[model samples]
Target: YFFRDPERRPPDLPGAVVAPADGKIIDLSLVEAGPVHDSAARKVSIFMSPFNVHVNRIPVEGVVKALRYSPGKFAAAFQSKASLDNERQYVDFAGPYGRVGCVQIAGWLARRIVCHLRVGQAVHPGERYGMIRFGSRLDLYLPPECDIRVKLNDRVRAGETIVGVLHETK
Candidate 1:
């Protein structure tokens, strides 16, 4: 149940950003320009309950530019601080329109983060790349130009929900 089936389908809309994990959207905010990416970006935090699927999916089709692992505290995933203090894996993908970043965060009940993609690897939207063993959070950092589709408390399905859309900039 922590992996994807061959028949599973993601949305077909162009430039759509899909949810990386199944859960309720706990937070949505604009992060100040930081080390994760050069420009300020929007963050979508999804809290995966014990009953939700633990598998993680790719938010867009792109080349994996980097995969970073950070060891930190096991705070509750739903808290805003958990995005910075919790043990996590950061995956950066260079999509056609812009860059997309996904962070797999370990919650209080989660002990491990499993990411299967490597730097330079090409991945498709909604493709299973890794998973957190149990309850956890998945944070998606989107480009500043993208329009967010989900709001706080919205329920989302991994690989099936359109969480945002990347608008083309000239």
Candidate 2:
């Protein structure tokens, strides 16, 4: 169903950002942003209801640096600690302009996370990297310096929403 969207294609675009997964954005916070790729990083939590599309896409163009897979309990992903304790994958991407991160989490009822890209793999913007079977969540770790254009409780369409700007890295 998600493949039918023509805007989901990958290409170089100025100030063009896409959703990392198909779901509803439930929570947003201004946390301690990371360096470089995550300079002005704002943390966004996306809750994928069972009825929503399960496919996940890359928000920007970049190469995979490292994949951190941690095993944990299948708690609900809406909680704050769920991001720290849930079974998820930490994907780091390096791009020409900057770097970014994506966190795929398993919800209480969902238990599978399929990551299609490997370390050193070059993925384009809006490319399908993997999926979370059943209900799930995706966290976008953005640069702290980037301008957050969305708000909490806002419904964002994956592959079509511009969550934030990709600031030019020094």
Best by lDDT: 1
- RMSD values for the candidates in order, in angstroms, are 1.8, 2.9
Query: What TM-score goes with each of the models?
Result: 0.94, 0.87
Error of 1 at 67 (Å): 0.7
- Residue-level lDDT of model 1, residues 37-149, one tens digit each, is 78798888999988788889999978999889999999999998999999999998887768889999999998789999989998998899988988699999998778899
Clashing pairs in 1: none
Give the worst 10-residue stretch by lDDT in candidate 1.
Answer: 1-10
Q: Quote model 2's TM-score.
A: 0.87
Per TM-score, the best of the predicted structures is 1
Prediction 2 global C-alpha lDDT: 0.77
User: How many clashes (backbone N, Cα, C below 3 Å) per candidate?
Assistant: 0, 9
Runs with alpha carbons beyond 4 Å of true place in candidate 1: 1-7
lDDT of 1 at 57: 90
| Residue-level lDDT tens digits of model 2 in 1-170 | 53233446544566555778767788777677632243456788888888777788888777898888989988887777778788998898888657788989998988899899899998877778888888689998776666777888777777767788776677
Off by over 4 Å in 2: 1-12, 33-40
Q: How far in Å is the alpha carbon of 88 misplaced in model 2?
A: 0.3
